[model samples]
Target: MAGRKRRTLTAPARIVLCLLLAGISGYFLYHCALDVLTTFQLKEQIAQNKSQISELEDEQTALQEQKEKLQDPEYLKYMVRGKYLVTKDGEQVFKLPTTQDDS
Candidate 1:
């Protein structure tokens, strides 16, 4: 009996060893999968942020161009005349109704 005990693991001991190994493997796999998912999510967020930054930069460029245009006297005069209906001396003011075609 002593020699037999030394030669092989008992059935319950074998089961416990297998269960421990499986548990440890499962734990590591779960964490690895979680980390991979987190990395993908972070990468996706970074891509979205990059695209948004590019859009904002394009908008900033457009706004800068508009600001420069606003500084021009002729353009400013045109905008004022069109938007506020301002007229120079001896200029006839006409009120025209805007027609919208909804197709």
Candidate 2:
């Protein structure tokens, strides 16, 4: 037709089209990269929490064992004697030589 010339993509139009597409794709990729980074950070946090929880659980088990041991009268007496160095009546406590040398 006389009025309509053509509807083809010229060189400049193609360049602009390519640039637009690149800009849009770059934005999308940037957002996705941010998400990936956030996910990695969250995973690291979760791993740290898991390790802390494991350590706490181990400490709890040790404390429970200690609690059970403390419930025994003999263990309590032994702890007291070890700490206070007190001996039974009519028992002599000899002072041992010091292992440290006073150089």
lDDT of 1 by residue, 1-103 (tens): 5566546889999999999999999999999999999999999999999999999999999999999999999999999999899999999989889999999
lDDT tens readout by residue for model 2, 1-103? 7898877999999999999999999999999999999999999999999999999999999999999999999999998787778789998877777698789
Candidate 2 lDDT (Cα, 0 to 1): 0.94
Show pairs that collide, candidate 2: none
Q: Which residue pairs show backbone clashes in model 1? A: none
Model 2 deviation from native, Cα RMSD in Å: 4.3
Shift in Å, residue 89, candidate 1: 4.0
Q: List residue ranges in candidate 1 displaced over 4 A.
A: 1-6
TM-score of model 2 vs. true structure: 0.72
| Residues forming the 10-long window of minimal summed lDDT in candidate 2 | 92-101
Compute each candidate's TM-score over C-alphas: 0.82, 0.72
The candidate that achieves the highest lDDT relative to the unseen native structure: 1
